[model samples]
Target: MTEIELNGSSAGLSGLTAVPWKNGSLNEALACYFCPQKTLQADRPKLGKVFTARNLSRIAGIEIRWTTNLADHLRLVDDDQVVFIFHCASFLQLQKSLDKSPFPDSFLQETLDTLALLFPSSDNETTNWLKSLTKIDPRLARCGSLRTRERRLENFNYWHDQLVILKQAFDESSPRNISQWWFDRRNGVQWYTFWIAILVFVVTIFFGIVQSIEGALQVYLSYKSIQSG
Candidate 1:
């Protein structure tokens, strides 16, 4: 019963201890691939884009270059060629469980909603899509109560995959709505204001120093004139 949690989301898997993702989590996912017997028992469909280490890497936002002593990197003949390597049973259990659950979408929707509130300009399309997803599949709308590891893992993977799919479609969608929009404007304004304030302060200090020097020179000249007289 390995347990895994990412970014505050938990995937509860029975009979598995949490094998925390270290360096090569992608490779670790690949190494954990199940045999046909196990996969079949789990009722995994054997068609159309079987998740590989590289694919999982993309999904997890991790780099292919990363690896650890616990897991080895995958070597493929070509980019298009598909390879099914062994992943930990716990990994499959978690991913499969998540694939069937709604928690992932619920998390995505909640996160998007919060972002929309905090950063209105950036998350418009994302927030709208999340809302629409909930409308289309209201089951996806509600968060799951804490459950057993098996249930949690299934739900977590289900929602995680859903979010990955949504993010990909969002990326490819028209005008690609992202959080970058809100940040770009705010960062530019802040930088501009910072430099402008620095410039004004410098100018004021420069004028003060010049006035002080002028006063000192005038006083020195007056004293000299008095001595001469």
Candidate 2:
């Protein structure tokens, strides 16, 4: 099994090793495809409309066959021949659709979460796969560019940050230590709730202390009045 160093810890590359390709060849192929060289874009109109699996295939010049299994989808056989599968596994999964609008943060987070299940040990490979998926479609490729502005850049940043978060979550979820589980599992709402709970506790304690002081003062005043009477 191949190992990659992540955050000073060695992590196994189970996802890549599990592929059908030989270990040496798989590394070579991934290196070649994921190099810094810019991929050649097909001469096509900017993808502005809603994209379907069929039309997306037509535009990308690649056959994106639907697969019932997500494992088949994540495994890349070749650049031209690829299986485009979403995270859904049910019959209604295919009913899901995407449009020109920027993808919601929830959708992007879910997609990364799915990818992390397979590529848990390798953030580089996981991010590379994400980049490859974006490059396959002109619409995604164009919007993912650093030059793209408006909501497109926002969409790109959202996914990019989500990948970082996924990496952090994976690091925290390492088998060596499970104490940090809550660190990774926390979402915005969860964190908000956690802080609110702490705040409420502090307020309650403060009020309790104030009431004790007030009660003691009242008792002392009543005792003094009785003595005077």
- Candidate 2 lDDT over 143-182, as tens digits, reads 1212112112123222333223322322232212222222
Clashes of 1: 20
Could you tell me how far off, in angstroms, the CA of residue 116 lies in candidate 1 after the best superposition? 27
TM-score for each of the candidates: 0.26, 0.26
Model 1 regions lying over 4 Å from their true place: 1-186
Native-vs-model 2 lDDT?
0.37
Writing each residue's lDDT as its tens digit, candidate 1 over 1-229 gives 2244444444654222233444456435423431111111122222112122222333322223321111121222233232112222233234445655322334333323322221233334333543543212222222222222322113332123332332232233221122323222324575467568878999999999999999999999999999999
**TM-score, cand. 1:** 0.26
| Inter-residue clash pairs, candidate 2 | none
